[model samples]
Target chain A: MAMDRTEEDDNLPRRLLDGCQRDFPLTPRPFGALAARLGTTEARVLDAFRDMRKDGLVGRIGAVYRTNTVGSSCLAAIGVPLDRLDEVAALVCSFPEVNHNYEREHAFNLWFVVTAPDQARRDAVLDAIEAQSGLRVLRLPMLEDFHLDLGFKLSWS
Target chain B: MTPDPIDLRIVEATQAGLPLVARPYHAIAERLGLAPDDVMARMARMQDLGAIRRIGAVPNHYRLGWRANGMTVWDVDDARVDALGERIGRLPFVSHCYLRPRRPPSWTYNLFAMVHGRDRAEATRQADLIRAELADACRAGEVLFSTMILKKTGLRIASAAAE
Candidate 1:
């Protein structure tokens, strides 16, 4: 059923977003290979990708490195006063090590991921955030990943 | 495993994205002063090492019409979390699923799964499906819908990784 839904939405641009989420051709002419698989011209694939990228639909075409494999990172959250939420979130986002920061609907509103060279450095980053914000930061490093990939099959219905 | 200096260079070069060209690897190799074959071989090795999860395009879910992004956390029995997490991770709607340590009193959820939907109602409906899958093992659960993206540039390795 899900497969059928995906097949229904099959097109050059949709395939690029859904099909190429993983196992993207690693050949010399990747665009050519993708074009071959999708039954389109290499130029068409490239143009479609460029357009999607320019439109902010595609973040990037790259490798999704495993967290804590090459470096270290942890998901930490902080509960800030409602009034101070935006100010604190900005402070958290200022750190280069802090890659992803989001304002969620919860008491622990400010959530972010901090990446560093090693465990020691990662801890130091959390500490600095704590010190600067004057609030406790809850560190939740991933213990295990149950999924092999983060690919999502889009529905066009 | 830590990437060697050369592999690190390869990672850094492609971190932003593979070059938009006919021969992307050749482009990376030319810029890094390495052979195209060498670049591809190193990336393949990195993928085997589990250092590179996958090589592909990352779509901006919101821009793709997945507006409701929910980080659904659940409190499950410690003995059953790993098993349940594996099942949850396979769900069509769950983009990411992992087991993280419980921070206690304030934070007791050990399971975190990311679900995307076109709207909040759809996102909630997906969460309910996971709840049904977990059955009695799930003691509590809450979906944290992201209200704003303060920062969202993917990981920066060259600057932070060991030199």
Candidate 2:
């Protein structure tokens, strides 16, 4: 049964969000491959993707680099009050470098990811955030990377 | 191609992981009573078919003292998203980059890139450099350091060795 996507006010873009993730195929014929898997035409797939850009369902699909191999990295967060959460979250998200930022149900309401070349530069990035956002920065670097990569499967159960 | 039961079986076996042993393929073949090379060849084909991405190491950043991870989102003009995204993907620091749709009133990012480092400080710092380089491309940005390490699972491709 086709689930009602109208819960979000009958939005077609929202309905296609999951489908959009499906739209990107790992195969070389990526677009066409994904389209065939989804039982749609490549042109339609392209159009929907183009439409998605105008609408803003995601920022970009790019590589998530490995920290240790490359050079350096860091994780930083701030305790933004609930009221100004969006403002700060937007500020944090506005930076092209800040990828996965979220408001967990906690005092440290605003969280974000930061990357840089070395420790000195990494610290500078944090400093810039503190200066621009004016939120006290709680520096929490990773002791280790236990597990990563949560692959998304578009094949709906 | 049309997927048969054997393909399905392969999928089931590989979902968890390929064994952490030298002869993982042989172990798998033993269960199926097929030659190890046969299993390896099938795996190679299935991987080549895009049913599985790449078989590689997923290091624990924390263990290595490089635990910082960040996802950099970009809001670029629709006209230049793909080109700009391709450029971003090329950077050595960039591991995963892609184009995605942003749902309004809920999410407002159209491009996403991830960066990993030895620790939180290292990750956040790299994010800063990226932001400066992208100063013209994006209007705003922020970094969120992970407070807790979340669930990390292995292959979900259901190839024969994982199960």
Q: Could you say which candidate leads in TM-score?
A: 1
Candidate 2 lDDT over A1-157, as tens digits, reads 2333333323333334444432233232444554465555555545554554444333323222234323245556688887887777777765534534655444556666665434776677678888988887766554323222333222222
Q: What is the Å distance of residue B11 in model 2 from its true position?
A: 3.4
Using all chains and alpha carbons, the TM-scores for the candidates as numbered come to 0.93, 0.47
Distance from true location, Cα of B40 in model 2, Å: 1.4
- Candidate 1 pairs with clashing backbones: none
Give me the candidate number with maximum lDDT: 1
Question: What's the lDDT for residue B148 in model 1?
Answer: 92
- For candidate 2, what's the TM-score of chain A, rounded to 2 decimals? 0.55
Judged by DockQ, which candidate is best? Answer: 1
Tens-digit lDDT track for model 1 on B98-161?
9999988999999999999999999999999999999999999999999998899877753633
Docking verdict class for candidate 2: incorrect
lDDT of 2 by residue, B50-88 (tens): 544444323333443445667666666667666667666
